[model samples]
Target: MNRTNKLSVIGIAVFTGVAIMGDAMLSIVLPIYWSDMGLTAVWQVGVLLSINRFVRLPINPLVGFFYRHYSLRLGISIAMGLAIVSTFSYGIFSQFSILVMMRIVWGIAWSLLRLGGFLSIIQLTSKTDRGQFIGLYNGVWGIGSLIGMLVGGLLIAETSIRFITTLFGLIGCVTFPFVPFLTPSGKKEPTVQKTTTDQQKPLLALDQFVLTLSTSMVMGLLIFGVFSNTLSARIDQSYQDNWTFMSFAFTSTAIAGIIQAVRWGWAPFLAPFIGKYLDHTKHKQQALICFLLSLSALFALIGSINQISFVIVLLLLFQFVSTGFVTTTDTIASDLAEKGDSIKVITFHTIMVDTGAALGPLLAFGLLEYFPLRVVYLIASILLFVLAIGWISWLRKKQNDPFAFSVRK
Candidate 1:
C-alpha cells in the first residue's frame, strides 16, 4: 500500500476502535450499571441495551439511501460528528429515559458510521484484497471490545461513570481530525448528471436489494437473539448457582476472536484452495454457506441446553466455528456482490445483521417466558433450518442462471 492507502487504513482502524469502545462499554458494562441504579428487571436491562437497535432499523436504510446519493466521506463525517456529540451528552444525563434517548441518537450515529465506513473501506481496496481487508476490519472491532471491556472494568472499579464517558469523549475528539485523511483519492466515480429524464435506473437491483436486506436482518436476529442473548441466558440459568456462566461466555468470545484472527490470518491462502473446491463442487457456494449456517443453528441448540461444564466447553468450540463460518460467509458475499456496489451490499448486510442482533434479546426473552429454554432453542434451530432450505431452494430454481456475481464476471 502507498502513503494514501496506509493513511486510509490507519484512519479507519482508529475510528473503528474508538467508536467500538463506546459500544463495548455499553455491552459489557451497562448491565452492571443498570444493577447499580436499581433497574434490576431483565426486561428493563434488555430495553436499555436494545432500544438503540430498534432506532437503528429506521436509520440504517436511510444511511444506505444517502450513500447512493452523496459522497461516503460526507456521510461518514456527519455520522462521526453525531457520535462525538452524543458521547459527550451520554454522561451529562443520568435519567433512564434521557439515557435511552441518547442511546437512540447513538444508534443513528452507529448506523451511519457502520454503513459508511464499511462501504468506504471496501471501495478503498481491490477485489483480490477485500477478504483480507475485511478480516482486518472485523478483527479491529473485536479488539476494540476487548480493550474497552478491560478499560471499562478498571474505570468502574477505580473511578466514575463520568470519567469513563469523558475518556470516550476524548477518544472521539482525537479521532475527528483524522477523518479527512481516510477519504479515497485513487478513484473518481462519475458524478450524477443533472439532466431531467424519465426511466431512471435503480442503482441496485430489486432482487439483489431484497435478498441482501433479508441477509442483514437475519444476521441481526442471529446475533441479538441466539448468539448473544439466548445463549447467555441459557448458560446463566444453567449455572445460576455459580454466577460465572456469563463471565465464561465473555471469556469464550474473547478467545474466539483470537482464534478467529489466527484463522483469518490464513484465509487468504486457504480461500484459494476452498474456492477451487467450491467452484468444482455441484453445491453452490451460497447453498454450502447455508449448510454451515444450519450447523451453527444446531450448535446454538446444543449450547442452549446447558448440559454441563464439559458440554459448555464443547459449545464454546461450536461458537468459535460459528464465528469463523460467518467471517467466511461475509467474504463470499463480498466477493459475489455486483461491481461498484460492494459498500452498499455490505451496508445492507450490516443493517440486517444488526437488526437481528438487536431483536435477539427480545426474541429470546419471549421464548424463555413462554416455554422452556430447550423449546426456545429448538425453535431457533428450526428457524435456521428454514432459512437454509429456503435459500437453497431459491438457488436451485435459479441455478440455470446463477446470481450475477462480480467475481464470476
Candidate 2:
C-alpha cells in the first residue's frame, strides 16, 4: 500500500475505534447494572444489548446499496452524528422504549461505520498484505473498546452510566475532522489474481461462501456475542457481590472489563502478528481449525472451573483465544470479499456478524434463565468443536476433487 492509502487505513481504524467506545463499554456495564439503570428484569438487559445488532441485519445491506451512490464521508458524517446522539441517550434515558430507539439508531450508525470501514480497508490493500492490515485495523480500532471498557468499568463505581456514556460520546466528536482525509474514495480496484489459485474462485462458490459465512457468524456469536455479554454475569454468579483476586479487590464488572481491556490492549501488537502468521502460513485452513478447536477446549475448561484463581486466568486465556479466532475469521471474510463483488460480499459478511452478535446476548441471557453457566459454555464448546470438524471435513472433501471450485472466468 502507498503512503496515502496507509494513512487512509489508519484514519478509518482510529475513527472506528473511537466510535465504538460507547457500544463496547455497555456490553459489561448494562449486564452488571441492569437494576441500577432502571431495568425491572434481567432479560431486558439482553434485549437492550442486542437490539442494535438485530437492526443492523437490515441496515447493513442498505448501507452497501447506499454506497453505490454516496461517498464514505457522507455516510460517516451521518453515522458520527447518530453515534454521538445515541451515546448520549444511553446516559440520558431511563425508559426502556426510549433506550431501544437509541440503540436502533446506533445500529444504523454502526452499519454505516462498519460497512464503510470494511470497504476502505479492502479497497486499500491486496491479498498478500490484506491479513496484516486487517489485523492492524482491528487492533487499532479495538483500543477504543479497550479504553471504553477499562475506564468505564473503573468509573461506573464512582460515576453514573450517564456520565461515562455522555463523556465517550463527546470524545467521539473529536474524530469528525479526520473523516474526509482518512476515508477512501470508494473506488473498486481491478480484481487481480496472482495465480489461478483456488482461494480466488471458490470464495464465491455456494459451499465455500456458506462455510466462510458460517464461520464468521459463529465467531461473532461466540466471541462478540456470547462471551462479552456473559463475562461479568458469569463471574458474578460465583458470588453475590465482589470477587477477590490476588489480595486486590475486584468486582465482576471491573474484572470483566479488565479482562476484555487487556485483550484489546495487546490487540494492537498481537493481532497483526496473528494476521502476519496467516499471511505467511501455507495452511490457513488448518490454522483456523486450530483456533476453533482451541476455543472449544478453553470454553469448556473455563466453564467447568470453580476456583477463583484459575477462573480469572482461564478467562484471560479465553480472551486471547477469542482474539485469534476473531482476527482469523475476519481476515478470511475480507479475503472472500476481496475476491468477489466487494460491496455485496462485505454486506453479507457484516450481516452474519450482526446476526451472531444480535443473537449472543439474547441466547446467553435466555439460556441462563434455565441452564447453568456451565451448560451454556458446554453447549457453545460443543458447537465450536462441531464447526471445526465440519471445516476439516469440508477441506478434505474439496481436496479429493480438484475441480470442487469452478475455474471459469
TM-score of 1: 0.76
Worst 10 residues of 1 by lDDT: 190-199
TM-scores of the models, in the given order? 0.76, 0.87
RMSD, model 1, all Cα superposed? 6.1
Residue-wise C-alpha lDDT for candidate 1, range 361-390, written one tens digit per residue: 777777767787777666666666666665
lDDT of 2: 0.82
By TM-score, the best candidate is 2
Model 2, span 1-409: residue lDDT tens: 7889888888888888788889888875887787777788987886887788789988888898888678777887788889888888888888888988988998998999888888888888877777788889999989988888777777999989988987898788777877877786654433544456665646436676788889988988988889887888778865455656788787776677678778988999988899888877656677889999999999999888787678888888888877788888888888878766777888898899889987887798799999999999999999999999877777766666644422222
